[model samples]
Target: MSNLSKLEFVALDISGKNFLPWTLDAQIHLTAKNLGETIIDDNETSLQDKAKAMIFLRHHLHEDLKREYLTIKDPLELWNNIQDRFDHQKLVLLLKARSEWIHLRLQDYKSVSEYNSALFRISSELKLCGDNITDEDMLEKTFSTFHPSNLILAQQYRERKFTKYSELISCLLVAEENNKLLLQNHQARPVGTNPLPETNAISTRSKHGRGRSGGPHRGRGRGRGRSNTWHRESHNTKIDGGRGSSRQNTGRPHKGRVSGDKDNICYRCGMSNHWSRTCRTPKHLVEAYQRTMKEKGKQTETNLIEGAPNSSSPAFWSDTHLEACDFIENVRDV
Candidate 1:
């Protein structure tokens, strides 16, 4: 009886798994072709229309289903018989849809879009089953299912008294984007690592560049540097003798030091090869080095003194004292 060459929609299976949507598609297509009345009992549709409707219905049925209803010719009788066989699908689908709706929660998804898509899908199924979900219900469901940490945010959103779910979703999406942007900003610089002010930046770069470029040391004796260098050379000689020729061949001048270990460098003599704890430099020698730095700092402060009438002012003294203390603390931390 299936004389049509093309399928208008998904064919109804023998188990009637897609019975609901199949019936909907069948009705719409039949109506469009002027054969809709043939499927309604006592509608007085023409014989030609009935034959066309019957052929359309049979064409959209599984091969097994067509054989099962093989003897049915009248479209109305065929529609009623199919309905009687698959009508229980509505109640079954309704129960499944209700269960899914009850278990759905916004917090279960990582993003708002995913949760929104699931909400609409489940809501559509419920609608098809004669259960309509209102906008207020959707908003409440979303609000109630927020993660515990966002309870305050959820309350604030609720206080807005949004009447439509789309409006609430729009606000949530905007907030989500803002929060993501905030995290990116924080990660770009992070706390306690901000760039120094322009003056400080230039001063720091000049100081390090002078040391690396072997510029003449200011307000410091060359004797101390020569003594420190001799002590390190002698220590390396001792290590090479103690460890034997095999290890000596591969050992570096400062075995434990590398360029990346800047923080572990000696603060006393500005040596990058060793830490202050094991520095061979004498205590008084270290003290002299610190005093030299303090004098240099004071000389700079004298050139840039501000907020004070003269160097004798209490404000000037306070500023100098603070700078000295900061220098001491930096050395002590090493």
Candidate 2:
């Protein structure tokens, strides 16, 4: 009934990706629905079902994405068409991600956390491409990601050969914290100014390093060691027809992380899972969100609504039948 999976929507929205398993699962789920099973049949009803699936796919896709397969009418053919494209497309993406990983120089970023997060993001992309980087490789990457100024300290780390990444990170964090304290103590600016203008400058530098060369070294450990993953399961389990267990994968995982909860996240709203983008949210739920936000008084419903169509939501359709399937992706700046 829906177009893309939660993971696929997030992938497309966040990284402009389409994890194969997620998309395949969505198509499979759709075809398993009413009339979907008869897509291969030759009867009028079967043809109707296939057409319905085709409509579903067309309806769910962001406006721009539909153009590629616009002429294809068969549901399975459309699915195959998309899959064929992605087969080549994902490989290119994988290459690009790997290139980023290989060329990532620590001197590029300013903060350790920022640098580490970027590195981990690359790591995640590598995983998506079936490249399982080892723990040692990760550690080596971490060690390799220091600014030239920290070379001596990094050299010392090589000599020390610390057993735990966390332990090493802790030391680095302590050192960073101490450095900040010293910087504050020796602040040239007045008290009214920022205590650590130097740190702020570093942060700015780190953020701007995108598509640039040298990456920044982490002076401190702001996050835990990257051993744990993004998945967290519900403690509450229900028995379904004497089946083993029933659970909901509620929380959204980060880009690099993977937890199979296709039904959870909505690709449209870019928020919580368990809802479809095409379906309007329940009134009660909308009211609840409104109440919560009204108390906070920040963003509102207007922010989420699609604005007037621009050049991006181009009119590809000449026929009236395709109108219901038309989708606008709600263009936004990257």
Candidate 3:
């Protein structure tokens, strides 16, 4: 009595697979309504074409389809499950075909998820063989090499139900430790089997003969004794007496010395002993020179002003000359 199309019923039936009941009558009704003929009498209909037709029907009845019948939102998640199933089926087929060894070479992964995914894929693929090896055993064999993180992850995975990709890093840590041990064990031994003449482990005298070379002599207590002798001599009366005499005679005229009187006034300008060049009295010649400079500066400034279009007025020249005169007078006073 339901007005639902026949293709919709067929899609629902196909999508449900063997879990759901398939009614030939309902399928024929759907084929008849949509294709204008019954497909139940088909002769070797391809599953691909059937799947495509089902997809078309599913799209047409998308709103009617339940969430359970829909594919996973993430293609990768869907692919992971699909790949697991495919790998299992493929491995079984390969074994049936009598392929001796099932080898799977995995690509390097940076992320933990990538590693987990790859491991999951490999483990799932290997599971198809139904060999004596268990999932835990396969994981252990795959991660036999020592990597720090991988080792920890492997232990964790064994204790826990899930295997993580972090276990692969164990090999790297193990290799590092091995290299460190190798370096530590590498010793530079003397070439000759017989040990070299055993010299005194604690020699009182140095290898260099005492006083033979210009370098300091090396004998027990010699250096310390010499240092004490030098120290004593340095502070003794004999050393102090000579130093005291040099200091006492430094700025004082010794016996038979005559002292001259200091000058009272400058020589060059007949001023204070500070000297004529440095006298406080201002030189008229400098003032004359400055005056000449000011006059020249004024003339140059006047010429510059006269040349400027903005200073064409007579008042500008009168004001400029007055400013120049004031500057000259100020200098003269200084």
Candidate 4:
């Protein structure tokens, strides 16, 4: 066997039972040969058959492995024809392993080869054709390019959308710091220098009256002069107005006689001090008045209680006296 065949045999041996079956391999090769003959002879095969053959080869062994077996010089050209052959999960797992291995080597050696290898592995495994780029850029682009449903799935895994670029950068910086701490005994340089003093700083005055613009005589002397003038004018005006009004009202002569003079008496009550309206009397005055009136009417056969000489008798009471008694009774009830 050739060196390449020997290598394939060794790879199959290492893979053990996980490797493709001999019978499946024969069938795939025969199918490929027939398909090739039909293409060369210009004989059309149904798209369905082509799809079925592709599925059969992919299930048995991936397109890349099949191309390796065919010893294709330019395998990338066959990538499209073989992409539908493999299990997507298996491809993703292989790509993930390759990506992680390349990333691990990146810390030791920063090389374009390592980066390209990682990219090619990831793109091939993901069946990603267009827009393959740097892993960091690719991850961001892929996250951005997801369909709504796929984005929701990614959110479930990542716990949030790809917003907060600053926060993400901060987290990355903190992670880098933690890694450095682990490797360097937790020591780090301080971030920045202390700030310089401002050039236009002002000195505060220590004494209360030291900084006055007019040297202490300025505000107080001017303020007192204005205040005294205003106060004198206001006080004089008030005093003059009060005296004038009092003199005008009091200069008029007294009218008739004072209301409570000794010679006068209440017309309704024969009281000496108060008028009839203000005289105090018992509450039963109305009933007593009615009874007296009724008695007078029987005796005189007329409503002559006011003009009768009997009304002036010593036992006779006045209407004002009755009213005073009623007022006293109301006060008692309250």
Candidate 5:
């Protein structure tokens, strides 16, 4: 009784719906147990082997079948009677398989795996019914069932002349994955956004007219070491009175003796008596100026004007002088 519970497959049902596969499982299990010959006519198997085969067969039978064949003690006779009773299943399965095969189309399934699985299942039934499906047949079936939009793609695959179905499926799966990745990237960062920079990933533009290395001409400095000295010397003479030094202000107007003087005007807003950093103008106006400076190729450091919040700057330029001469005339109105 303990061994009987170890039946390797489901018991045959009274309806015989699973008769074909149950027969196959029974044969293989019997062969593995060295009792295969007991089911053949006039076998010379020992009595012990015959008992083992009969017990195995009976254990796998439906309750109704067991009662009907209660008197049949011979394994060969029981096997033959069961085969004769359900043999018509082959004909029924073959007809259904043929219909499914006739209607099978790759385009009808959403993915290659699904279509391949269905094809293999149908082909398995056909082969069991003595109808073999070859590799060429599978490849042709797939090629003919591509969606109408993929006609050209199908033609290209056919041109590759793959002898095996697996090779074509591999290429198609790879292409599908790549296309998905491309779409994901496009959707992540849609069009008209800031384009990726091609060259010069480093932006030397400083937030406070200073470079990462803390040189005075940092933003305008170009070409390694000497540009720092040239920038400090050239720009300081105009803005810093040749002090060549950095000054930290408390956002206040710098004390000055003269008003209405040309040199005392703020370079940022074209106003008098205040440095660009300490000007009290609205932030939007300063941002507009920053944009204009960029449009005019002035390319100020990320700080743009002197008094904005400090943030990361953008790519620097080699030229030292600010190209604000023409635009400075219009700054007074702003």
Candidate 6:
């Protein structure tokens, strides 16, 4: 009974659904047996029950609407009066919704997906307002709204029959993805790619294989160990065929030096007569060398801080260190 008292009337239309005064009236009549509405006709008690139901229906209405219903004592008349006023409001709301649908555009949204979603939302609103929209009509409207550049594709799609709206949307998404991929491929070369002349790969592979095996093919060291190894060639092709010229050699190998003996090669500058440590032509080499030294210093400092052999510095195995340094130099060359 207390819950029933809390059921206030609220006048709101749900398109085709039930609304306020209707809900209040139905609740009262359904629960009337408990409220004593079944007792007598035109009697004081019966009138009181009907009055109670009408008051609940009228309680939450705005002042102007309430005043209009005040002259009607019966619940049914009050309901009819409220409907007459709200029906007019519904027409005004429908007009506003239709105006929004007319002004909506694909350009207002950031992407194809967002534009499509907004178009559907406006179409749905218009439908609720009594516009009889069909999927085929929606498909044509959506295609017409695309940007002028995209409209060409929309027209191409029109040439086909039996294409659903969903299929068109899927096609648009696929085309968008393909365009992005093509743009990406155009902007940057992929990794591990040597797009330079095919000869560079052959020359590099030959040098690499010989360096790894330290074999006779490379003059069998010719008494020229790691120190007197073959020098860099004239062409310093980039690993990825990128822009910018290769690092210049500081000077030509002293006129008649054997090409197999690159003992004094400056791997960083592709120059001979000076080692990488001595070469100062390439600025990047200086930075990398400094960075390597700093990292070594930091490692020594970390060991001391952690209380590991604080008395004396750690010793490096010469052979292993040399091999590791060679590997690093090879990577920098690439």
Where does candidate 5 clash, by residue pair? none
lDDT of each: 0.78, 0.59, 0.42, 0.42, 0.78, 0.56
Tens digit of lDDT per residue, candidate 6, span 1-334?
A: 3644553444434341334334445556536534434222343446666766666555545566666556778765665555665555545656876787777765566767876787677676566557876768767766667677767776787777534777777776788789889989876755544343332222332221122345455445454343223343445332222322234444544333234545666556656775565554646655686676667655443443543443344433432335466657566665
- Across 109-200, the per-residue lDDT of candidate 2 in tens digits comes to 76666766787788877786778876677678778878878899899987888776666767777887899998988787555444432321
**Per-prediction TM-score to the true structure, in the order listed:** 0.55, 0.40, 0.19, 0.18, 0.57, 0.38
| Candidate 1 displacement at residue 328 in angstroms | 59
**lDDT of candidate 6 at residue 1, scale 0 to 100:** 36
**Model 1: per-residue Cα lDDT over 1-334, one tens digit each:** 3437888689999999899999899999988888888887679878888888888999999999899889999989999999999999989999998999899998899999899999999898888889989998899899999999899999999999999999999999898889899999889864755553333111111111123223355356554332111122232233333322212333546453244655566888766766675566655567888887777755433466545457877767776655566657576676
Question: Least accurate stretch of 10 residues (summed lDDT) in model 5?
Answer: 200-209
Q: Which of the predicted structures, 4 or 6, would earn the higher TM-score when compared with the native?
A: 6
Q: lDDT for model 5, on a 0 to 1 scale?
A: 0.78
Q: What C-alpha lDDT, on a 0 to 100 scale, does residue 259 get in candidate 1? A: 49
Question: In candidate 3, what residue range of length 10 has the lowest lDDT sum?
Answer: 228-237
* Stretches of model 5 off by over 4 angstroms after superposition: 1-3, 194-334
Better of 5 and 6 by lDDT: 5
Model 6 alpha-carbon drift over 4 Å, by segment: 1-75, 160-334
lDDT of 3 by residue, 274-331 (tens): 5454444445544665576567645433444445434778866766655466658566
Each prediction's total of clashing residue pairs, residues at least 3 apart in sequence or on different chains, is 0, 16, 11, 9, 0, 5
Q: After superposition, how far is residue 10 of candidate 5 from its true place, in Å?
A: 2.2
